[model samples]
Target: MGVLLVGGLMACAPAVSGPSQAALAAPRVALEAGHPERLRLVVMGDQGTGTETQWQVARAMAAVCAAQGCDLGAALGDNFYPAGPREVTSPLFRERFEVPYGPLGIPFIMVPGNHDESWLWGGDGASPRGAEVQVAYSRVNPQWVMPARQYQASVSGLLDLFVVDTAPLAAYLPSVRPQERPGGPWDAAQRAWLAQAVNQSAARWRLVLGHHPLYSNGKHGDAGAYDHLPFTFQRGGAVQALYAVACGQADLLLSGHDHALQLFAPQPDCPGTWTAVSGAAGEVGGERRGRRPAAFEVYGQPGFLWLEITPQTLTLWAYVVGEGGAVTGTEIARLSKGS
Candidate 1:
């Protein structure tokens, strides 16, 4: 339930990926105002398989956590591949788990990923299901935390985060057959639950998170991956879950299915709210096995996002993580909220 969160410092000098095409596209969106910042939150996703770079970044972030007074870490999902944490106590867990963020030791909470659930809950009890998986994960990892499947969580009073699972929505397509779905987040009960959660959260910031991204100019877009299956399904409303925050109650939405990073804002008719795809956490290097459109302005780097929240402004920093867990290329842009 509660974790004491171990804190430490970070090593600087990360692997230089490249310049963000997003910055090259149009001018960088300047912040409304800059000033005294309050909370500094780090966002990392798609690190389930574990990489030397990712592990190094986590180690580095641990130090920033202490200096910035970071209370927790939000793990976007796919925390473990080929299966979630079913083999919680395995040696791979040590190399992949304990070694990576063991330095940070903060309460790291996660949403589900296609890879995580495939191993943990879905794929039949033969894989890892019921209390067995839960017991293994919770009992073994002292720093790990995940809400009930399809649930919302409160972060520091200012934000209420609705963590959604999109697997079901995508699987519902005719290709997959609704009844044939092994598992997915697109459930009727979850829909009702999310609606109620939004209405109840009066926080200044409402964010919905998941593993699959809703908007991105990454390799996952266009041609093949453009299937963006979930976005077009059930009318745009299914993909529109990312837009729940567009109403203004929500400010930021995050995901990481594409294995790349892209920051999005009001493009054409898509108004309100900002979405980010933080899929590149030292895995595929931003190159999804899919084709992305030329119009897509991508960050084109191997790194993660850092969200810095202050009493006045909320800033998102895209940092490039190095092999040793250090992050550089600190670029800060604020999220504007007017009174």
Candidate 2:
């Protein structure tokens, strides 16, 4: 497996309870240049159920990594169902995450989904400390790499990953009261940081990883009008505005809120960036809700995304896992820009 040089961006103002500034400034390791830079990673989301299905997906991911070699994993979000861990020592961390994914033996770059930040059923609200607890766990587990709620990581000079927390930015969930949100001016700081980072990044590819999708063919639909409601348009407007920075500047926007796997062609709003939703890692959801069309859609089955990035091209594969962890990969997608 190739080395991933992960570092946090310090350009944004820090959150009150996140990692220290010193930790965010940690030095990055340079990749050797004798060979062309190549990186392989798996991206999955909504997978913290600790059920047989989750284990099946984990086994499938392990099999693929064992066969093709994955250097890193990106856990899109909703790591735990219903609510997130109460503390770093919560058994769910071991059973749902560590134990199931141990065989892969790679660090997961993570973001917090609505379920991970919720305090009750139906994922209607956020918990004040749920996201913070997960951030603290990063200090304990090397394989779980969420250094802060939002940070930028450079991966071997091939990809610059901007990981953002969308729990506070989303609008469909009505139960999340203002008091339960993150303290300080988190929303504005994150947007400023991402805009500057994406515009200034010199990496071969710039990708944004978050919990919510700017565009989706699944249940949640798109941001600004989530769930196809006009009322939500006003509440969810922030989400659209936040991601507008990456519309044409970033290479890809990867997210998972709806429980399906989908790949959408670049829409007029975000003409330069492709959108992918891989939320079926644990429980599968229904088919597309008809809000929009997808270039590819997979549901009623567990699946994930595999990406192979080189200096010349960014190739992607969508993998579907069947009963007994039978793995099948198909429908390759590639993106290239003259270097």
Candidate 3:
């Protein structure tokens, strides 16, 4: 099937699975989309199969999102672990998701992860294919939705985020390759669109959120995940584009596929300052047996990322939720506005 984006207005490409005797229902909102003024949003990611951890992570972030009175929440990727198992609209999503995040009652905008697609693509149509998965997700969980393979969200117009799917980071490969794939107008369209959005908006920050990592010291190897065969997260100058987004003086960018957390300041190599890898939503471990990176200030823990913003300053934190639903991991970063 073709990429079916339901919220036609937004870049929502949901994988569509045909006819389900039972499916999650999506609440039809007017065919309208706009960014409100001075809004607060919650961003989290990589809450894989860690039933306990994902739950704790959701509860904590939900509280913050609710308390902050934010209308949107973000998730990075690999949402469900061990390769999605094809049957996406299962209790796994509803029970694990609709049940917990529903209380927040806000629109949860998300991107696809290697896990989100799962075994569906590996000859598992009965399990639910691409856009169909999205359709199912929307059907089962109205409070949540995926804006196509790529989409855009303007944070009060002050910030415009281009969310892209890096799953194909390394183009489509039968062997679960390492790098990202060459995408459609998604990345290019996003960059060109960003140039226009930034010039048009009176807002101070322009950020990008996705499931992959550009600058990371975590489990994944270097900047490029070519693996000597194929795949390049650097496709279409992906990394350059990411940095360009910041070089253009965009405030910050956030992502969550690494299972750990990271923060970057204005360094010589990068002028505009960047921070990301905040997933830790629920899983305490990563794709490779919970190994902690030597360079990571905090690693191998269960936590979530939080962002508190205002006209004057922006504060970001990492909360490590521990045993008995306990949270111990916390890191804060304060950013200043560019003149």
Candidate 4:
């Protein structure tokens, strides 16, 4: 990836192609000048391990939110370990989620990951009940939000978030256990919902959040060729085609499954959107496989992402946490039509 400067911050441009000169010359404008109030959000994923690292990341989040301000949180997925909770009342909910992130004092829009939908392990798909339990918990706790497997949420009138459940789509791929396949047509319905929801939404910014990534530089790789399985490559191609609606229309595609923090510049397929992977909330330790060129990529560290959005701009700060759960360095990116 080539180096690009944004607001005096050095960022790696996508390796596939360089950005336009106009984008590189775009000025770093102040977010508060004659613009709508900015919305602050914290994003993390694969964090339901109930481990010390998860607590550490949560503490960092609390401290950051305390110093700054967070209006909402986006929990990408893998909410539960091994398998999801046995039921909505399972103690894991408290020990893993409620207790660790309770101090954030904001609602977390959540989606389910492979582990959350699996029965024995992540590879073998389990009953949909695992994910349903999480959705049911939404009624019990206002902070835990998951109205359905796939839903749309409008946040503070600035963002329209379209959440997708990609576990079944991956599980439904070839060479997977038969029992893991979803009972009905899930992919079609989700694609339809996303295409319609994004087109109809009137919000200034649109984001699609999911458990799996459309593009990643970590081990799992992109939507196609996940885990580098060649047989599934074709199926993964279908997966990418399904997400074309959001890739072409939405402003950003955010996900977490690679257990690392990554930011990729727009790709040829997903030209209009940026790809962000923040899956290192609890687990950390992965090689930058370099499956794709990334604007920013980091591994073996536990951290999350912060975003400040206004009608005209969306600024991203990728925070890297050190051994003591303290922020070490920040990579900033200011994105707009010109940038």
Which candidate has the highest TM-score of all?
2
Q: Candidate 1's C-alpha lDDT?
A: 0.52
| lDDT head-to-head 3 vs 4, winner | 4
Could you tell me the TM-score of candidate 2?
0.86
Q: In model 4, what are the clashing residue pairs, if there are any?
A: none
**Tens-digit per-residue lDDT, 233-325, candidate 4:** 323554575578887688888899889999888899788788899999987878888656788888989999999887778988887778777
Per-residue lDDT of model 1, residues 55-84, tens digit only: 556665665666665545677765665555
1 or 2: which has the higher lDDT?
A: 2
In model 3, where is the ten-residue run with the lowest total lDDT?
Answer: 23-32
lDDT string for model 2 (1-339, tens) is: 234332221111111233454433222212222233777879999998888888888888888888887877899988998788888999999988888986576667778887777765635435536777897897677677776777776655677788887777663444345632333245666777788878988889989998888887777778876776655422456677778988999988999888888888789988988889889998687776755767788878898999988888888899998866778898657888885
Q: Best candidate per lDDT, number?
A: 2
Error of 3 at 39 (Å): 3.5
As for model 3, its CA RMSD to the true structure in angstroms is: 7.9
Q: Between 2 and 4, whose lDDT is larger?
A: 2
State each model's CA lDDT, in order: 0.52, 0.74, 0.54, 0.72
Alpha carbon lDDT at 250, candidate 3: 59
Per-model TM-score, in order, reads: 0.70, 0.86, 0.71, 0.84
Q: Evaluate candidate 2 by giving its C-alpha RMSD to the native, one decimal.
A: 5.0
Please say which candidate is ahead in lDDT: 1 or 3: 3
State the weakest 10-residue window (summed lDDT) of model 1: 24-33
- Candidate that beats the other on lDDT, 2 or 3, i.e. the better one: 2
